[model samples]
Target chain A: MRESDKDIIRSLKIFSDVDERLFETLVTAAYAQRFPAQVDLIHEGESADFLYIVLEGCVELFASSHGRETSMAIVSPVSTFVLAATVKDAPYLMSARTVDPSKLLLIPSQNVRDVFDQDPAFARAIVTELATCYRSVVKSMKNLKLRTAIERVGNYILRLHDKSGKADIVELPFGKRNLASILGMTPENLSRAFGALQSHGILMDGARIEIIDRAALETVSKPNPLIDDFRS
Target chain B: MRESDKDIIRSLKIFSDVDERLFETLVTAAYAQRFPAQVDLIHEGESADFLYIVLEGCVELFASSHGRETSMAIVSPVSTFVLAATVKDAPYLMSARTVDPSKLLLIPSQNVRDVFDQDPAFARAIVTELATCYRSVVKSMKNLKLRTAIERVGNYILRLHDKSGKADIVELPFGKRNLASILGMTPENLSRAFGALQSHGILMDGARIEIIDRAALETVSKPNPLIDDFRS
Candidate 1:
């Protein structure tokens, strides 16, 4: 097996636990593709052709409304993104783009369907993946409906800190503009929100954010399912 | 098989086309249970134990939001409802109730899992079912985000006309309030939306509605991949 192909399987949670022989079959069927930074692997209205397994770097999941894009999720290393479109072979609800120079495994949507047919475990994994996707969307809807801009940004920074193993400082995944869209706020609103959080001592930072006071932020936000967890 | 069960299966799109043996298996596995109007078939937050095939009358799918009831969908006769939750074995996201004296095929969720494990065709059926469910939700979201209350109600009526195969008239499965909730608008808003449409030639008489001018309604509210033409 090619080294890059091994990296592909290793990066995907759904395939990581499967035997090497099965991985080889999957790798044989898949083509390792490099997407340049900002390249779109999928578009909102296009028919789904493949399922992406991110080997390196990150990808953005976003929807466009009235000619503006809203970032829905950020797919990082070792994650199977867009399983819903792949399994259903339906047109994508959002577009996917590389946030960095990324290596991805392009498995034919048919291969995914065939695999699920033959492997119940694979079906179960895909089900879990889809369930997670649904829950994340539900969380997003709740966040859009319930939280204020400053509260959303503060909770988002806390999430990044938690994701980084409680590091004091963590770099933002995308620029403040993209992060604002993800939080369903305007760029100006996001800037103001960040400033407010910093003033309140809930968070602090330049490009890298520091969680100066987690307890205070959590108390204010009340950290519902959306703000408290990404997987939910 | 009981005559009523046979008639119900004949009406459903999924079971109507399958071979007799498969249909018989599905029908036999399902036990007919009756509930009085307003009785809960499945309660929100409870473990989802059964997949219901509504054979007689209507079921309203709803969840409580800040002490207010928000409807998810209306399940009509000869259609399977809550298949997604049943297959996942997740707690019910929405409560279901009989809007009238309802006879339903209560297939244990466990039976669904067992059947899917052994039958590839049945598994394919499930994939189709779930895929349809996902698409329906996506369409609803699009409608909610893109359309006004007036346009939403307009498209919904057109959708009903398409589903019931009635060019002139279609019956409301649930009341105006539940329909309003499903469309993500208020009852008063739905009433006004209907009134606005009536002034524009979309006809309504009590619980029955008639699209006197289909082209005008479609012109006012363009339904794209709309939640119309659904079969159980």
Candidate 2:
């Protein structure tokens, strides 16, 4: 890996408190690779071999059952995916694929466990990261169980709007089919949800959504912090 | 706490690796209490103050939004709940309530963090626990998003049957209403799902389910280990 790439990995919260020598050892043991768009990164039920860090582009973590598949989460740049599986030395619960041409750092799971055993700081960081990941999934499960498809879509838009500094126009990060799957809706239902939202405050032009009335959207979405706040 | 209770807590996988002196500090900081059935232990959005260990009976971990409620999980005896929230010093994402008269141990969250920082063994245990928890939720999300209500109900029954040593008769651990919510279905739909399953070689007597033909039940359920295997 490039020195610049090593610097970026070192700066991540999970590695920020690590001893410099150990951090170098970790980076030295890892390798970086780039993949084209829509390339499969890992498959569910396979033993987690490497802990993946997305350095560029996007990755979608998804799972399938009985021939039906659904998107679980989208991993953006400068973060890790499947760390839990890597930590537990367990099978990957979800499959991951690139949404666009992506670069990733692959650290051997054994190396990670070895470092974690030797470094108290890294172990603490792992606990924090895993806790955050666990809570995020709990929130997602609550959203799925407690909200309707339209409500889920509306709140998802609100989240994007907030992430974009409350912009008037926000672009969908991925395709509608993927979004529908992420929000636990069918493509047709997602289209109808967008149609239903038009009467509230938003105007959808293909993937670009114009938030004409933020208040109206919030009222309809009823975004709860427990469910929608990613940072908390 | 009784000596027997302390022994039980020490025997838990999360506590098994801790230094004996530090383990004593943890138990010394914790206190046990008994609560009546239907008691609410923690509320969503409240800062996590204690790491709760269920000593007796059952606790239901649930969440609500927009006046709609759903059951997320059921914690039975001799296990911890909300460890992630406690570790992160974050708000509880789900409310927990006692399903029956119960006994519990409440360890101050600060104590957990302090011990976690000082003890490498404890930290490693926390990682394993949190990783297992994170994977469990991911599996649940897959189940919810990828399967129909009928499929979920059937698969849930299969899991129960497996847990009961493949007994011909398996009883639901909790109420049907709780089961319905946990399975992400309305009571009406759950009833219909059970009704639909009769043709698949199962008979329901109140909460007691008799799997008259295990093969037929498995055929309809199509139980995937990725979704149904708790140990995995």
Candidate 3:
């Protein structure tokens, strides 16, 4: 059973591309845990005890403002979160709640960082993960600071396409209100942003959003690493 | 001459506590270059050519929208900016321009990284620096999305106090407009924000801003990372 679970972890990007020995060590250090929907796995400003990997269901990451929460990212199956705090041994800046019945692997922070100290390649892998996290946050900042609401949703559709293996007709990841917070706007504003984009040729059908005229949409919404459409 | 410069490099937090021999290797690898104010040293979306240490003067890191630019960080002498770009071997996300006549020591991208590979302690140093950068950006994001304009200015004054070594009379490193951008508001809004904070009992005379009421300010402005209070 342990060997089969090791095989499961072997498929994750952090472990998948690495040598068998490192994968073996990581799997040995990490153990699987589970959570139910709406469960607060890690409270904002709480102790940094464990780093989590979502093996099933979904999680919402958010920060609070004036008692209201703002969504940052929604993590689905096969992704890690809360690492910035875990690695640094600092209190989490954001709280995470399970958005669906979930299965996770919680690696004790000390056990995880011990791998960093014990293995150079593993250290390199963690560095890559942190760098990737840093880039994602930068992209988020660019999205929030550089683009207005309408362009953000338009390009968000493009990103959804890209994230869903660059396929057509991927379902929406989060509910509209959560997505609005992630996009740095209110839900009413997000609905208006979507309407404005639709009038400009981007179309939405229930959970599925489609770019009817990709070129015109790109022209209308200038994209960059923020929007992931540079020429726009 | 080398010894004096080593002393200078040793004064920087990023390099000050580094291994002496590794520091010498970096010193040997670096070339000192001077630039006039307003010259762009690094441009967004381009390969980062060199990792720089400003030996004199200041540089502004700013990002642009449809021609509107927002100042990101005002990097002063003896500090390193863009460490993430150099360490991660990625294109810079923002452009850097000289804000004052500057002498900067340029360490080739390859050299900074190669040094990282050769010395584990220096590699640890680099990781610490990257962590610091990530934390600062995270703090900036909190300031942007969570805090009110008046709260931001009040906290900015507290930050300035720390930046000036807890000194009461502190001259700012950047012009008000640039600082305003970094604080994530229009210059006029920044003026109003400062005015609001002053009305709330924070006192200012020229660049020498003072926190007359600490508890009131703390109630209004959030402080995470106690390191802000511990400059040394």
Candidate 4:
């Protein structure tokens, strides 16, 4: 393995406590690949071959039913996606596609399972990672089921502001259309939702958003830490 | 361990391949309890202490945000809930309540973690269980996001029909209001959704449902295996 790749592997939380020999075996079988924007990385119902960790750029996980699609998540760098499928030796549950020119490290799923069987620490780490992902998805479901589209928009903006270190203006990570899908609304509904939130003091201009009255918007959004705060 | 409890444990797919020693250890650390209907079994935000396995009756997993509550899933007998939190030693993301008089086996989270660390077979079992759960949640999220409320209601009825051996009439597992909450809708909205679906040839009376035209309702629901089928 390249020294830089080794450094990246060593830095991952999933690999941190793994024994040196198992880590070396895992890293040896892993390879990094670059994909252009809109490349389909994995498809739902396809055989699970590799566990993917994003090294750069972003990937969008989505699901489609009867030609209608809904975005599930926007996976960012330094994190893994699809570990559940890899560990279970099951088919991928969601389709993944690159949102930009992205770099991804792909570890053979067989090696992952083998290492998990041979190393207790790696098994524990897998449990931790899967649990976190599971909980995050639960929270996402809560956000969808408990909140209205307008409230979801409000919370999404508030989350972005907090994520960007409480900036008065937060730049969207993706386009408004993609944001609409991720937030579980039509682009038209997203536009209307933003307009509706203007009454609570939110202003949006293309990708830049300004929270004129955080308190009022918070009232409208009702962003509970249990549901909205990923870190907590 | 009681013979009955051992039989129950042996029947679980998650515990099927577990080592005998580890299984004995797990059963020794486990105890079953019964709760009356409408009783809260586990609350959100509380530290997870036990892994719950439903032995008889039904449990409802739900989340509350602000003042509103959303029913997440109807966990039936012979299944487990909150495994993710127990595995990771994290707080419960959703509160669990009994929908009927229910029997549950409570295994100390520490014992689960210990056995998981010591027994490779148990660890593998956990991976399979967690992965199945993670995929199930992913599918649930897809259902919530990719389908409208009426479509959700329609598809839910269709799923129940399939589950009940494709009977023309299917029994409701729980009350209509609870089913409404589970599908992310108001009871009023559920009524309206049912009314909307009458055109698609669905009929509901109390807890009894009849699909007058399965093909017509199926077209409206668009049940995709990727999003709706749990076994897929």
In lDDT terms, which candidate is top?
2
lDDT tens per residue, model 3, A120-201: 5555666666666666666677777777788788788877766777665667876888888888889899888888888765
- After superposition on all C-alphas, the RMSD of every candidate to the true structure, in Å, is 4.4, 1.1, 3.3, 2.1
Each prediction's TM-score against the native? 0.78, 0.98, 0.88, 0.94
Superior by DockQ: candidate 3 or candidate 4: 4
Instruction: List, residue by residue over B1-232, the lDDT tens digit for candidate 2.
Output: 7898899889888899899999999999999899999999999999999999888999999999889899999888777899999988999999999998999999999999999989989989888878887888888888888888888999999888888999989999888998899889889999999999989989999999999987887888888999889896
**Residue by residue across A1-232, what tens digits does model 2's lDDT show?**
8988888888888899998888888899999899999999899999999999898999999998878888999889767899998998989999999998999999999989988988989988888878887888898899888998889999999999999999999999989999998888889999999999999999999999999998999999999999999796
Rate residue A106 of model 1 by lDDT. 84
Every candidate's fraction of true contacts kept comes to 0.05, 0.89, 0.12, 0.78
Interface RMSD of each: 4.0, 0.9, 3.5, 1.2
DockQ of 2: 0.86
Off by over 4 Å in 2: none
Considering TM-score, which of the candidate structures 1 and 4 is the better prediction for this target?
A: 4
List, for all models, the DockQ compared with the true complex: 0.23, 0.86, 0.36, 0.74
Error of 3 at B185 (Å): 1.1
Best by TM-score: 2
- DockQ-superior candidate, 2 or 3: 2
- Model 1, position A187: C-alpha lDDT score: 87
